[model samples]
Target: MAKKTVEAALKVEKLKVEITKLKETKKNIDQKNKQLKKLKKKETKTKKSKVEKIEKKKTKKKKVTQLTERKTKEAKEKEKQKAKEAKEKEKQKAKEAREKEKQKAKEAREKEKQKAKEAREKAKEAKEKAERTLEEELQEQLSPEEIEGFQIEKVNMEKLTNKVCVILAEKETTGMIQSELWKKLKLSSRDGSRLALKLERMGTITREKILEKGRWTYKLIIKKTPISTESIENAPCLTCPVEQKCTLEGEVSPRTCEWIEDWVTIEIKKPKTAQ
Candidate 1:
């Protein structure tokens, strides 16, 4: 009985040692499992950080592209505005040039018109001076005695006077210029001028100084017309049967003569003719 009890105690001691060794192995395995779990968590966190960095890089690239496009659009718009301004400036310059040319043409026309006006005035003055010189030379050619003795030959004085007076009367109060009247009467200028002076002295006409055709000249106006003797050519006084004893109150008086009365009445009733 004693030997069996000793053996049983020995067996209990062996079992206790084996249980302690198993507990030590289980503790080592739990520690290794905890380290493996920690390693897996660290790897997952590293992968998440790498993904965030890649996303950030993509977003930065997109922002850069958008900013570049906006700048390029602004530059193009500025260039277009500059081109428009340049075109407008060119248009304005052309308009100003046209206006300047038009003004220059107008001034030239005015200057030409002024020159023509001056030329016309000079011509008129020269013509007047020449006429005055001619008139003075003509007067110098005639002596005082020759002018005083001037006369038309082969013409009856009374009949010529009546003709001149009648012609002057037909011209009316405004009268005719001396040069034109001389031409119509087929007379020389010197002879017409002398006759005009004689007529003025006789109080039969008047001469008025005037300007005609840019020259100093004279106008002739009639005062009176002389009587003509042709009106009494058919009277019975010279051919009557009575002798020269007819008187205003005698027996053979002209106041009581029937033949004289009849002759006078017939002469008055005849149509007058210009002589």
Candidate 2:
């Protein structure tokens, strides 16, 4: 009975020791569980931060790509606008050029019309002037008898002819109009017109058709002056005793007259005097 009680006490002690060891093991397991839980929490926080950073990067890249596309679109639009403006400017320039050409052509046509009008007027004036002269018209209205009977009264023909020559000489080669000559000579138009015609017919004056005081008229120019009386002062016919009987085909002919021959010879030998 004593051995059995000792054995039982030993057994109780072993059991107590086993209980203490179990309590220590339980504490160690609790501590390990706490550490594992803290590490898991830290790992979860790191993963969340990485995910947020990746999201931010993706958003930034998207914004950058959108900005690049927008800028490229804007550039393309600007280029299109520039090209449109250039085309419009070119069209405007062409329109202006066409307008300028049209204006030039119009002005040229107007100038040509004005030139043609002026030419027509000039031709009309020339045709009227060429129709007839005043002196010719005056003579055509007179009869042959009236023209033959026309003479200046109280005027010596030789003196009158010499005075007309002197006046014409003063006017040089340009000559004087018939109206101005008649006024200076104090002669009537009727007599003056007849005298001018007679002088022109006699080969002592020439008549040129001209426009004077807006009328067709004559310009008289001296062709030859009248023979001076002094030129015949020593002529034998004036003093010859047979002057009445002397004729070109008579018995007392000038062709066989010795005195006339001698007088002609002497006049030919004399030096000519200037008028």
Candidate 3:
């Protein structure tokens, strides 16, 4: 019995030791579980912060796009207004130019009308002066003895004054003398008028009369006497074929006569020449 009690006590001691080791192992497993739960919580917090950052960036970009669109619209509106104002200015300038041209044309027409009126007045004054001269010459009557004496005087004068009167009366400037002198002179072709015969003998005067359809017209010329001493001194001693070298020919020879039948007596004051 003593041997059996001893074996039982030993077995009980070994069982107590095994129970203590099992308890220590269970405590280690609980500590590992707590560490895993702490790691999962940290990972969830990091992911949530990254999503919030991406949303904030998207909102900022949208606001910037709206501001850019507003600026572009305002710029286009300003450009349109500038173009409209430029077109209106061009139209106003064209209108002013047209009005100025019209005013210039009106002034030119008025100037032309004034010039026409002045020319008409000058023509009327010229006609009235010619009529008065014709009336004065018609008042004198001629006697047969006086006619004979008058014929002699007419021939001796440098030129035939009556023939000159008839030529002057036919010109446009002296047209007023036509009605007065044209009726009194008998239109004849005979070369033997007492006035013409006396003029032929004098040798100083030349007369040519033309009769056309019962009307008589006359041309009278005067012979010019040159200074003979001056002619001889200026003459060329040598003979030349050229007419310009022969100065003596023009001075000595008879000149081509000009008809001076009715020269108007116009008295003009001589201009003073420097001494």
Candidate 4:
């Protein structure tokens, strides 16, 4: 209980960190906007100051205009050039500020989005963890009788394999589909699939995947034993009476058999069926 509480608290703390990061992103965006606004205000002040300077020049020129008309003309041209230069400079500064604000805003948005994604991932993990914990708790609380529908039993692999081989031999070269075969064998689909793969890997049988109803199904093809008529007829094991007890190292073995030696010599000379 204490451990679980600690884990929950840790998750909450992580979530708090994500929230703080998001807040910081927002604050940074707000600051950028404020700086942009200040730049606009500065441009407004520069325009206002230029206007005041132009008015002062106009007043000073009015008094000298009747006395020197040519001089007044040159002064007006110079004032116009200065005003144009000032406007251009103000425009450049505003453009640079706007570009900087856009870049900062993009960065802030990306940071917020990243934080949101991380929060979502954390939330998903937490939800899965809680679900697993609840499942474990439920399992601990319940008895065998309380949840008594399903039963799991161990599979006798050797028995199952022999049975499967027998079934396949009956079918011969004509293979049976996985679903039908498993149903007939009374095995679960999952277990049957595993068995089929096992047989395939061991070279006992071949399994071919087929698409039926847009879902993958298996066709199990049995690998028949390679035995020709002559080989079976010449095989000493066929005529051996103590075949059950016979081994290569035993007294009733093929090593000291004169019958088998003669049969092999004859087979080498001329091939014939025993029966």
Candidate 5:
């Protein structure tokens, strides 16, 4: 029993040494945990300082971008304003040019009217002078006996007809206006018109209505040939020569007659000759 008790006492003393070693190990672990916590705090503080610096740099760059963008906007606005001013200037110049053109046109119209007025006045004065001189010359040349019987009378119809025929022949024109004939004839409009109507009735000319000078005027188509249409209607062959039986295949045919064939062959192209 003494031997067993001594072994159990030795075992209890070994357990006591192990408990003291465990207490020391726990104290070392607590010291290492405190050192790690301090290191973590220092790392977080350095990271926060770097983040603040980055934020400040980023804000400074944004301010620079904004200033440049604002400058560009101002430049665009200035360009727009300059373009607007230039457009307005061009419009003003156009308006002034139009006004100047209108003024020039008005001046030109007025000048034309003044010229026409002067021409009319000069013509009137010349006509009066000519009439006075003609009257004086007539008075000076006439004898007292001739002057007593020198009464004005209408122009002779035959003389007027000859004058008109001569005028038409000289002009050799296909047609003429009524006013044109009076200018050459020096006859009043009413007298000239009557003469033209008389000539038309005599079949010496044809008159057609045509618009001229914004009014209807007569166009005189002269038939001045000596061969009258009556001469054709009174032809000897037209009255005699079997006029009813004259045909291409009949006994009295135009093709068979030597005189008709010869005349047609030569005069077909000559409109002046009566075929």
Candidate 6:
């Protein structure tokens, strides 16, 4: 019985040892499984994060393209509006210019009409004056000698009158005379004398008296004619007798007469019989 009991105790000790070894092996297998599962879960999470980042990048690219396209459209529209405004402004300016040109043309036409009317009135008045002068000349009666010697012609009347007046100015008391004025004028003595007397009566000439060799002589007087300021300033001083005395200082000086007179005497003698 003692031997059997010892054997039984040995058998119980062996069983206990076997059970502890099996528990250690089982714990090591479970730890290995847990490590593998953790590794798998981490890989899956990393892949998901990478996919999300790619999607975000694609969305940003799409938004940038849309913004750029919108900006381009706005720029094109602004340019079109600017071009339209410019065209409108140019059209308005052209219209105003045309209107101004039309107004100017109308004013020019009115001014031309006024000028034509004035010219016609002047022509009519000149014609009437010429007719009256012709009638008066035809009504006058002339002597045979006068008619033979005197004939009026359309000529420079002012020049002829000046020449005759200059010649007669040397003789009468007023230092002026119209003697033979009609003969010089190539007109009838009656008509010429009438005109010359009219000029004298109008105060164009006068009479004066001078003593010559103890006798009183009658002379004609011609009033001085005024010269234009431009002529006085531009006239040459070389021919003046008092040029040396005149100076540019102080007041303006008087100038000598520009014209001088000359006279000649004539005698008529009876013809002598041949000896």
Q: How does each model score on lDDT?
A: 0.74, 0.80, 0.44, 0.71, 0.67, 0.53
Cα error of candidate 4 at position 57, Å: 23
TM-score, predicted candidate 6 vs. hidden true structure? 0.32
Model 1 misplacement above 4 A: 1-36, 95-275
Candidate 4 deviant stretches above 4 angstroms: 1-156, 169-174, 223-275
What are the per-residue Cα lDDT tens digits for candidate 2 across 32-150? 77777777777777777788788888888888889988988999898999889899989999999999999999999999999999899889888865756646676788766665455
The reply for model 6, stretches above 4 Å from the true place, is 1-48, 51-55, 93-275
Instruction: Kindly indicate the candidate among 1 and 5 with the higher lDDT.
Output: 1
Ten residues in sequence with the least summed lDDT for candidate 3? 259-268
lDDT of 5 at 109: 94
Report clash pairs, candidate 1: none
Off by over 4 Å in 5: 1-46, 117-275
Write the residue-wise lDDT of candidate 5 on 174-258 in tens digits: 6787789888777666556656665765667777767677656677776764444433443445655578777789898776776
RMSD of 1: 13.4
Tell me the TM-score of model 4: 0.30
Model 2, position 145, has a per-residue lDDT of 60
Clashing pairs in 5: none
Provide backbone clash counts, one per model. Answer: 0, 0, 3, 0, 0, 15
Candidate 6 residue-wise lDDT at 192: 58
Which of 2 and 5 is ahead in TM-score? 2
Write candidate 6's Cα lDDT for 162-273 as tens digits.
5455565554334432333444446664555444433444455554434445543223455532233432343445355666766546232342333211111111132211
TM-score of each: 0.39, 0.39, 0.27, 0.30, 0.29, 0.32
